[model samples]
Target chain A: MTDSEKGENQEMLDVFFEASRAQDPVPGSDLMARILADASQVQAGFNPAPAVVSHPSAGQPGQTLLSRIFAVMGGWAGASALTASVCIGVLYGATAPDTVRSYLPALDEQTAELDYSYLGLLDETVADLEG
Target chain B: MMPLDTNDDISDDALMVLFANGDGQAASVLAYRHTGRVLALALRMLGDKAEAEDVAQDALMRLWKIAPDWRQGEAKVSTWLYRVASNLCTDRLRKQGGKRASEDIDNVPEPKDDAPSIESDLIARDRANALQAALETLPVRQRKAVSLRFLQELANPEVAEIMEISVEAVESLLARGKRGLAEALEAQKMELGLDT
Candidate 1:
């Protein structure tokens, strides 16, 4: 951690490095050849696909349209889940009396009114669809 | 989309890609370039030539198998190979129940006489033996960090990348490993007349 400690470590490392560099590693020529031979044998087992083409016309337009609609619905569902989680977290923080002290308590009244208006709109939309 | 050429200058990653496409020669080149480093690391870690050879071969073979899925520029090929080879050596060492009793290096075969003068060869061998003994005393991770950083001449970041640790962690390991080696080598130093 200190400068002297760092210098000593570096010096020792240099000595070890120099000593290791001086020693020659024995070659394994036959082992290397065998390994490559085995590798080639494994490579020979692979069968690559030839060139191919796909026609968009092979798919029906109606099926593609339905797939897009389902994809959009899935995206909406995910977004709704995320939004609901955020709203729940916010609401929980807002309503908890301890956390309420950290913010302007007067703002909660106006937020409740806005929440009612939003819920009323949801109800009306659902009722009209059911009717 | 260009055809891969064996004689052309290619990076290790490119060679890996060619090997993936079934060019055995590309694999051979990679093996030639990296095998010595891997074997040397394994030899230091395992202290047995036969096991080191097995570890090196297995590590290189894994490269050939994973060539198709290898993402380029992510890691140096030799660095990755050292990591794999070291891991294999560690696994074998663990399975064999920690360190084997130290063997007499006097029986170990020396390189051909043409490589070095007899006196120099003896001195180098003695130093190498002292290093090996000192290295064996360190814990496995420290030994690996020291070996990769010092022996392989890999930079700190490359050593950290291979060891799958942060740079700070690598530094700590190297510090501890070096101190341990220095302590172990002190007596050997007196014997080798390195005190002067």
Candidate 2:
């Protein structure tokens, strides 16, 4: 089709399409009501589930006090464990001996010879001069 | 504050704010106002009334669940609901292996007429069925654009927001979709003697 013809045809088609769309029916009222009811039921079912609040009178007085104490003790124990872990880590980092040098005997001898030479008391130096 | 008397009088954003503040009535009003439109959109997209109803109900349920955390003015509530419902419908269609092709568009009974010729009524039914079939054959996005713009009477920007596409994309989809529909209906039009 030519451009003008295509445009004309498109316009006609648009008219028909719009008419058909206008003919489409709206959804029924009962459906909306049902959906609303279902949503309300869902909302009611939520409501934070009432948080399972424990009434003061619901538990025995002695059990409540014991539970409170246990909770506090559990928290303190967790904090103490964490602190102890940190302290141990710090002490190990600060005071641990350098075993890396002790692992190699050759490295220890090289260090001793270097120290004697620095003090001007090397036996090798005297022997070389006499030769 | 006194409760809003009319659902239409209150904007969706305002309703969402009230719902966020724990207003059950506001939630109900919002649900009642938009459920039908969302259900209809789902029905047209999914081509099954029951599934559409399920999607609508599920969408509203989700809205209520999220109402407490909903931020007002962030988005239109209806637009949000449409997106959710559309996504749900798309999921259902995918899971069902796209077995929705056998929609009852063919069985859309003609309007009753006492003084009509059988041939004319048959012609009209054929035309309507052809249009429905053509619409069904388009890609989902194109079909959605066509339906929302023409059928749901939503504007371009609103359709864009609901479809989560740019306005230009919506226009492109509608243009291409209409061309495809025109081509598909051309043969049916010839059969119905309306092509000329």
Candidate 3:
């Protein structure tokens, strides 16, 4: 189209565009309330209740880090099992218990060979066991 | 906590990050700023206040949902909103499969005594309604293009981005849309007070 034609088209449409734009909705209080409500509701999901904790920051700042960890670990029952596991670990480490190694007697073959000579242990041990 | 009023001075990207970080005030600030812009576009596309409001609400809801993952500086809040509102309007228009022809003539504010003649206000309302009527005659894509380009006053590149089409495609749609609107308005120039 010629410049004049384009100008005419734009000019002609300008009046209508102006009028239409003037009547553009202002988003009334009710509409605003609803939109804000929806925002809050959806944001509620993004920032959920503190108890369904997603991160360290999601819990109460007043609470100790240890308590927070316990809360995250499923409360008293988890803490109880965790406590038992810790006690067992401390006992095992302090005493260096060998009952488990005694049960897995075949492991003795490897440990015994590593201590002495593999050929002497394997042959002597095999012969004695067969006899 | 950044004060919600102070958030007005902050960029939208900052506000989005604040919102993602669980700043309740940030949501309020963002909502206060962009809901009207989104609603205006949806209103033009849907041609019904209630439906447009619903679309606006849905669009804002989506923004709230995506807040946690809102990568700052990657996309603008306004552009993202316009794109979302435009798509929601398209879905609604397609589902309706027909023109939505109501404009709020009844809701036009009562003319004040100090204002110009009530007749002028009436003329302006008539022209707006007529333009809306003509807009309804457009294909949905053209209607969206015209609304985003002309009514929303967005640049062609931005319009293209919102419409997810090439710049040339946006130009084509707009040219065709303007031509159609010009022809429709030409037939009613006298009624539109353009004959003066």
Candidate 4:
């Protein structure tokens, strides 16, 4: 087609299409609601979920008061400190068994007098009892 | 308190920014502004109202999903939406083995009797339905180009952006599409009372 003819044709199509354009099919209300719902859902992702109050339950019986204290002491550092404390207590108990005995008058004299000979005497007493 | 008119005036890019910032009203504003165009394009492309509604919802859903990542100045919001809607319609069309559910002309929505432009409205409605029928007969790309350029009144560049084609390619498709439409419309002019 000639340039002039093309221009005229385009013009006619424009008018024809303008009418078509004006008659945009009204979207059903249900569709709009669904689309809006989709929008809300996506936007909801940006918000943080609501915080729920935690409660002690039967399943977590191991969460004793001491363990709870250790947990509250914060993460690995606190846990290491708690473990170190328990290790120190155990070492003191094992290496210094007489420390508490020395504090008691009844154990004080006996513990002070205790020697390797006492072990031999105990062994003989056990043999006599068995015999 | 933000004035509601301010929301109305906010650009799509700004509205998107607000949406990303967790402003719920911004999403509503954006949806209200563009849903009609998206729905119209899908309706014309699919020739099925139900499918068109699906496409519209899907496209807007994508829009909502992409709000946070929406880049300002990268593309026009309408262009992005129209492209998404177009793809959805294409997918639906493909699923039916490339056959559109042929719409009976009688089922075409009639102009309301109380419409001020009743006479003209009737003519336009018939012509529009005829055009839609003719559009369905074209290749998918041609139909999309013609519908975007003529029916949607998008500029060649805009149509190209939505179709992901060069403007020259868009023009070519539009030319060929218009020719096919002309032929189809010519055959229907008598029955549609275009001559009268």
Whichever of 3 and 4 has more TM-score, that candidate is 4
What is the C-alpha lDDT profile of model 1 across A1-131, one tens digit per residue?
67896676466446545655777575656977877786786566553556566434344456676555545556578668878999999898778966665587777777776745688899999999999
Residue by residue across A1-131, what tens digits does model 2's lDDT show? Answer: 68886786676566556444433434457766776676667566655556677654455555767566545555578668878999988887787656645677898788777744544666768878999
lDDT (tens digit, per residue) of candidate 1 on B27-110: 667877788888888888877777778888899888877788899998878878888998898898889888663556632434
Off by more than 4 A, model 3: A1-3, A52-131, B103-117
Model 2 per-residue lDDT tens digits across residues B156-188: 999999888999999999989888887887665
Q: How well is candidate 2 docked (DockQ)?
A: 0.15
lDDT of 3 by residue, B49-84 (tens): 778888999999898889888888888899999999
Please state what fraction of the native interface contacts candidate 1 reproduces: 0.43
| Of candidates 3 and 1, the better by lDDT | 3
Ranking by TM-score: 4, 3, 1, 2
What's the lDDT for all of these models? 0.75, 0.71, 0.82, 0.80
lDDT (10s digit) by residue, model 4, range A33-75: 8988998888889776788766433225667876666556775
Per lDDT, what order, best first? 3, 4, 1, 2
